[model samples]
Structure formats: structure tokens, C-alpha cells
Target: MNASDQNALVIEGGNQLKGEITPQGAKNEALQILCAVLLTEEKVTIHNIPDIRDVNQLISLLEDLGVEIHKIGDNSYAFQAKEIDITYLQSEEYKAKASSLRGSIMTLGPLLARYKYAKIPKPGGDKIGRRRLDTHFLGFEKLGAKFNYNSDHKYFEIDAHDLRGTYILLDEPSVTGTANVIMAAVLAKGTTTLYNAACEPYIQQLCRMLTSMGAKITGAGSNLLKIEGVEQLSGTTHTMLPDMIEIGSFIGLAAMTQSEITIKNARIDELGLIPDIFKRLGIQMEFRNDDIFIPEQEHYEIDRFIDGSILTVADGPWPLFTPDLLSIVLVVATQARGTVLIHQKMFESRLFFVDKLIDMGAQIILCDPHRANVIGLDRQIPLRGIKMTSPDIRAGVALLIAALSAKGTSTIYNAEQIDRGYQYIDKRLQALGANISRI
Candidate 1:
């Protein structure tokens, strides 16, 4: 939070987001790659990095620990972490920035692997639900890492005398959990295989980056991964994959406002099933050499099955509609001409943000903590904008979609919520020809 009397964003609604936009690099991927710098005392270069708040904060922490960070160019950084000082890590300023990121807990794995010890505080992120660290702890324990947690706000330590690799199975396919174990196991004493691990694009990118740096890893982008531990790893230059979530957000923005949009370098193959999922909401897209073009459609209708059955959009581990973009899909579903069921199978409280949409005149029935039924009005009555506050990253983007397509002006307090994940959201939306400004 920057020091100020009070600064908030005021948005005048009913302006469609038109024109072309390219997504910044993947935030999730950048976090993992940045932490990989601790694997060895070598210079690593990360290209196509997103200049978001989280990335900047993590870069600051890395530099504070004696890592030589140089901004080679825009969205590109070179890091050489030859030494680290954990005693200087206890500073409140660094700790606050470090703990503010959800992926900060991942530092434990790399620190333990290199220094044989790591003491990181409980990390913080969107308060959508309970993001537990039990999986992370259990995964490290399997790799010969011991943990001691003291709630007195001091002396939480993890020590590994020798990392003996073992077969580890995640209770749930947690993205960060898989990343942590992989980071720790890459420099372990033996071969490590992870089953039931999260294999999202972000996780796959991390695996690829590790492999490029001389870590022998297989089965990336799949449930099972085999990593051959190495005594040391060397630096390498790697580019992050395009952000599918940002692509989905732009798709939603275009559809909600009935505008055409083209996303450059979209990595259509990496999208897997996202294209077909958006098609269900009457959002048509054209693929052109790693680019996705969403054409303007006057008639938006949710496509029913051949049997005229109600369409159901559900999220799962992978090869399914991602939980990350479910909120954006739900907002688009609100304007389509039909009914759809959104089933959020992963998190419990993720769907609760729909209440704000209902207030904006969208018809949505909350089935429970994990499900919602949305009945689109087909733009019968224009949504009236109302002042609101951003709850989380995805939900904030959804609200922005709602407000941008609504009738009157809307003010979203705490614009910082959106800043945490997306880099320069308003400016990017403006680049897409959207009439949006931050106050």
C-alpha cells in the first residue's frame, strides 16, 4: 500500500473493449523461475517476464539476498545469486513483500536445498479460501526435509541434512505444492518421482526451465514427473509461456462488450480445452498462427447439446475449464442467451463473488459454495453500474468486465487488488481501445 490520503479508481461504464492486445508473460511461471535462481550460484536470465507487482516484489527480495539483478530490457531480467543472507531476510520491509506473495512459501524448498535450512513466514494472497501449506510440508518431508513451526511469530525452521529422493504423491494437485517439491528434489541425492502432481502450464513451464538449466526432468504437462537430482545446476535463458488466463480475460472483455479482439502469441496449443469452453457461451474465436481472434457477434447464445440439454461448464485438474478463469467465463455467461451451470470443483469460496454480479442485475443462483447457476438475459436490460470493491484477482477482473459493459459509471475501490496479479490492467485495457482510466 502506497502512502497517501486515499486514491481509488473511478471507471465510467458502457464502453466496450475493442482492438488488439497482447498478454504479458505468465505470472505463475515467473514466480517459479525466479525462485529457481537459488538452485546454483549461476546467472539465470528470464525473458518475457510480466512487470507486475508480485514479480517486482520478488525481484526486490532476490536482490536484497545479494543476487545481482539487472534489467537487461523491458520484461527481461538477469539474476546471479552467488550468496544469500537469511539474517538480513528478517527485516520487516523485505518480509512484508516476501510474505505478500502466495508463492513466497516456495522459497523454503530452494533455500533448504542450498543452505540446508529455510525459515519463511506463512505467506499471504487472495482471501478467497483456505490455501493450506500441509501439502508443501508433506512433499518436502518426503525429500528428507524436516520442519519445525512455531506460532510465536519466530523460529520456524526447515533443515535437510541430506536430501534423499523418494516417491511423493500429492494429496491434491496443488500447483505451488508440486513446484516446491520439484525445486527441492532437483538438487537432491537421488531420483525423485512425483505422482498426482499439478501439471498446469505454469507447472510445465517451471519443469521446462529446470530442465533447461541441466535438471533432468520428464513428464512435464502431465500428472507424473521424474526428476533426476543433480549436484548443481547452471544458468540458462528461458522465455515464459503466454498467459492463458489473460487471454481468457481479454476474450471475456471482447464478448461482454460485443467487440472484436485479437490476442497475439496466444499459444493456442497450450490453451488445451479453453477455446471449446468459451465457444459454449456463444463466444466465437478464430485461430491464426498462435493468435486468437474473437469476432463481434450480435447474437450471443449458449450452445446446447444435440439433445437440447442445458449446458454445464465445470472445472477440473487440467484438460478442463481452468478454475483460474471460471469467474471470467461466468461473467460472459451472464450476457449469453441461455442457462449454464458453473461448477467450481477445486475451491469452496471462489463462486461467492457472483453476489456482486447479481447486484449488477445479472441473474445468478448460488447453488452452494462450489456451484452456481447463471441464466443470461441476452442483454434485455443494461446492467447499472454501482460502486464496489475488488475482492480478489480474478473476481476483480470479472467486476471490471461487468462494469465496463454496464450502463453508468462504476468505481472499484482498492484497485490494488487487481494490481497484485495483472500488470497494468487498466493501461492494457486502454491499449485494447477500452475507455478506462485510473484515478
Candidate 2:
């Protein structure tokens, strides 16, 4: 879905949303898992898959490569790719559309590792900043992969027949860059050591999936990853990690509306530093085993630093607050008690959406393209919800968070942006007792 599928979301503000909402599987993790099917010749079962646009597009690409896919159950898929004919993917239309998604570019590493050749067009995604594919190419080249490029096209020629693993230190800890390298190194001839790797939950899930397929990997969930190549890969089953971004979004939604809600099966362990990040904003939460419950509260105050300095919430590699959820945090910060700095070092233009929040009557200082200083309104005057539109995936959810907290009805156009990352957002928020509807 694109702009044509745009819907008017009428959010009746000022009501406490109350109920339990469970997060779907991770979108980034599911994308990497889907690409793993190209590695082996056996049947593979992937569980807890998120039904989103990127995943659907990759599945379509897999089918076009002669992979037999069956939906076994809800959020579950059975994949059998005994043979892949890369010749079928040589068409410009297919390559262009396939590479339009960031996740689609990950297919290149796996395809080249297994087939020794892959034709991938320039990748496309949200126009938030300069997202480079050089990191991916650099990592692949370290593993003996050669590349050919033209003004309109790029193809990798990897001789996996003599592929040798080597040490690769990425220029940046790019998520897709790390994923591409991990997939390629899994079947290389020797051991590979990756430092400065993206150790997010999605990367950990990818490592776990590869381990289950008989590849030797260690130091998952950390910045360093060790991979020992195997002669062949046997297909196996692996489930996706819970989406922490979705969990944080719901937490913000509940806070904005003064709602009491529970996020069930939230996989708190995987969200190592996230809870404390929100805690800095003084948003209260109670953990009932695996569920995170937000109690009904009148107001949440932002906690200042020990030196009486303004609060600073920044994103880093894994075990830090994810950059993907920084926008939601910025929105939440706008409603808190004191001032806070929302720093998004990864994406330059992610903080530009603060203008929309300001339009809704929030006090925020746009520090730059990558940072914003949000002064909490403390509910002095409830946000006057107004007409708005979603800009990107994370910003879209942030806009929804702001709208739900506003005083009047709000319409968010291009809601498909939100749908790309979060699954069944409307139905799930409704179950949490939000007065939100789509027109």
C-alpha cells in the first residue's frame, strides 16, 4: 500500500486507553530470516513472522525464484527452496522493484554466497538521510566478492567456490550491512570475525537462525560476531524476536492518553536498556512476569540528570535505545514534565518531524537535523489535535502517539507508512481501548 491506500484516522483524544496489547514479531528480523531460505536445499519453517509490506515483497521475490512457500499457521510459513533459478531475476523490472526495499538488498549477499552471482539494482527506502550501500559492499568484498557496476545497475560476482572468510570491521554499524555480511560469511571457506557489528535483537535473531542451520556462531546479542563456515546448511526453524519498537510505541500511546494498558509477552530481556530509557521520562510501568503494564496516571514528569541537567535520550548500537524508537520517545518527551534532548545520530532527518508535533502545540526546539530539545508541556494545555500526515515508519507512529494525546479528532494521512513496521496497529490499539478509527 502507498498513498492511494491512504486513510483518515479519526483519533478521539482525551480518553484513557485500557487493555492488553501484544506485539508482533520483529520486522527487521523476519526479513533476514526470509533471506536465509536461499542458503539451503531443504524445507525451512519460519515462525512468528510479521505480516508487513517488506516481508510480503520478499516472499513474492522468493516465489519468483521457484521457492515453494505455504502458510502453515498464523504468522508462520513453511518454505522449500530446493532449487533457485537466478536467470529468472535478470529482468530490469523485477530487479528494480525488488531492490526498492532496503530489505531486498540483503538478498544479494545470500544469493551471491550460494550461487556465486547476483544482480542487484540500487536499493531504495525512506528518504530520511544518506543511507549508503557501501558498507554492505565493503563487507561482501572482504569475503572475496567482486562487484560490477554501471550508471543504472550493479551486480556482484562472488566465487564462493574459493570464498575465504576474513576479518571485516564495518565503517558504520549498519543493520542491513551487518545482515548481508553475516549471511555471506555463513558459508564461506574459513572462519570470519566481524567487529563493530550491529548487535541489535534482529541481528541476534539472525545469528540464532544461522546457528540452528548448523553454522557455528558465537557472541550473539553483542557487538562482536564469530562465524565458522560449514560445507552445507540444513534448513531449520526459528521464531522472530518481539518488536521492541512496537512495545515502546504502545507505551507512548498509553501515556499520551493517560491510559492503563498492558503489553503482553513483550520479551523484556531483549529490551535490555529500553525500559530504563522510558523510565527517565517518569512513565511508570509494572512488570507482571512477561507483560509490561502501564498504570493509570495523571501526569508523567521527565527526570533530570543527577547534575540537574536536562534529560538526554540518545540512540546507539544494541543494548542502547534503538534509533527506530527515538521518534516515539521524542513525542512522549513532549508530554512529560521537564525538558529533554532527543538525539538521533543515525538518521539525519528523523528529527524533522518535530515540526508536526509543534503544530499540535508541543514545545520543542529543533536543535538540528539530527537532534531536538523537547520541553514538556505537562498537560498545561492538552494538545489540540489537527490535520497531519505520516512521513516515515517511525515518525508515523510518533504522529499517532501525538494525535492520540491531543484534545480533538485528528486525521493521519498515508497511514500505510505506519503499517509497514507495525502489524495490525489499528486493531491492536483498539483492543488497548484507544478511540481511534480509520475512514
List the global CA lDDT of all models. 0.85, 0.84
Expressed as tens digits, the lDDT of each residue in 124-215 for candidate 2 is 67768988888888888888887666664554334444567899899988888898899888889999999999988888888888888888
Lowest lDDT 10-residue stretch of candidate 1: 1-10
For each candidate, give its TM-score against the true structure.
0.96, 0.96
lDDT of 2 at 24: 92
TM-score of 2: 0.96
Q: Write the per-residue lDDT of candidate 1 for residues 188-287, one digit (tens) a residue.
A: 9999999999989889888888888899899998999998999889998889988888889988888898888899999888888888888888888999
